[model samples]
Target: NLGDALAAETGFKIEMIPLPMKRMGPELISGNISFICYTLEAWLPSVKEQVLWSDVIFNNQNLLVSLGAKPITSLKDLDKKRVGVVVNFYYPNLEDSFNKYQIFRENGPNNESNLQKLLHGRVDYVVLSSLEYQYQKKLQPRLNAYDLGIDTFGVKCAVSKKSPLSVSKINQAIAAMKKSGKLDRIFRLP
Candidate 1:
């Protein structure tokens, strides 16, 4: 949908690629992909010099989820508790706590696996992106989510510096999408 919007807004061809969450940045940096949409600036640390980032496409959050019966009301409640987190994903709010042994991290392949770990008592809580949590919450009514505050992101698009697309063009496309309600249709965002 964003590809369609961008093509329409910018009068240029837009090719969308599906890559693993972790692979998108590297692919963009490696020039294998021209651009990736609806991503976090934090996700493209090394690409700061290699990509032209659009204005925020949207805002998103990462949440800490636990079973309803054993709710974690606050981040401090996670102290000394095992947290199920995705492998290689950054948890800015928990890094120091994990390094200081304040919380224990149990790595999983993805958010779904981490949620399963939480459900099975393998971990006290699981960290998941808002989209994943909302979708999973629909299927598992026994789950609850908590905001860790700093887990929010200004989601944007990154175009490789080599790409013909410019930040201004991409930003205009995003603005057009928001004006037309295309973004809401795509993400059903807050």
Candidate 2:
């Protein structure tokens, strides 16, 4: 819906392609897909030259969550526990931090799988974006979240290295939308 709104507002028709987030890296690198709409942090420096970040669509903060248990308050609290994490660039920070105290186990594919693991006691806790966690909590009221004082980041649409046309157009459209408040209106829509 947000992609459609951006297309409408900018007069640039964006092809909304849906793929599992886990496969996005390989697909984008192999040119199977030309663009990805995800958090800016997902862009690895190795692939950075192939992509351009545009338009801050959402603020994503990683959160530690568990099922109705006392919220995990510190890195020390994670010791010897299995932590579910999504695969990709975001895991490096978590891996480095959590490995210091615990045996970290990654639950891959997507958030649904990770959440299911937490629900079924396959893992002690999971790391996810706050927005995603909130949405999931609506589906599973038994879950609880904790903030670990990490800086929140922006989500952006990334264009492939070969698609200079798309990148240029998208950046221009995003700048125009930002100036005109169109982006704000789109996000505010119910």
Candidate 3:
């Protein structure tokens, strides 16, 4: 994992704290935690404004999922279609277009459920991370996907505004790992 690689590369002990999504920002901003990684700036705008971010750790592409028989390649393809989305996930540039086309937005607990919605024909399409779609597709082997090219977002590691760790130091460590290809190896990056 990138976290483990970062710790080893930096010669620092890193602890993983699993917290509720809403709690992560408040905790980080208050310095209750040292740093948090694998987040999108759009997912936590207020936290982004108050924290230090490392270079992109990875990119998450938001994809459109529909039945293979009826694939959707773009937002315009979603006009008047029922679309499933997980609660609390933001669809950046596509939302306004989805709205303008009067796309029906259905909410699900998570990606799997939205995927199930697509499989069962309960929704016309589902918006999900490409990573998740690929993982699920391998299991089901019947899921369909089309790249929503404009919806790619960067995932970053971030430190608190007043943490003991220096942002530059963390960035340097990440850069070193990148240079040595440790990050690509750990993440199986292409």
- Give a tens-digit lDDT track for model 2, residues 1-190: 5577566765755687677666666666776666766557454555655556676765677888899877677867777888887665455456666546565867567778888899889988888777777678778998888888544777787766655346667777767777877766655422
Q: Evaluate all candidate structures by whole-model CA lDDT and list the values in order.
A: 0.80, 0.70, 0.78
Pick by lDDT: 1 or 3, better one:
1
Q: All candidates: CA RMSD in angstroms?
A: 2.3, 3.3, 2.4
The RMSD (Cα, Å) of candidate 2 is 3.3
Instruction: Give me the candidate number with maximum lDDT.
Output: 1
The sequence of per-residue lDDT tens digits that candidate 3 reaches over residues 58-125 is 67788777777566665677778888987666687767766676788788877778877888889988
Badly placed stretches (over 4 Å) of model 3 are 98-101
Q: Candidate 1 at 160: error in angstroms?
A: 0.2
Model 2 regions lying over 4 Å from their true place: 20-32, 41-43, 98-101, 175-190
TM-score of each candidate structure, all chains considered together = 0.85, 0.78, 0.84
Looking at candidate 2, what is the lDDT of residue 172? 73
- Minimum summed lDDT over a 10-residue window in model 2 is located at 41-50
Backbone clashes in candidate 3 total 0
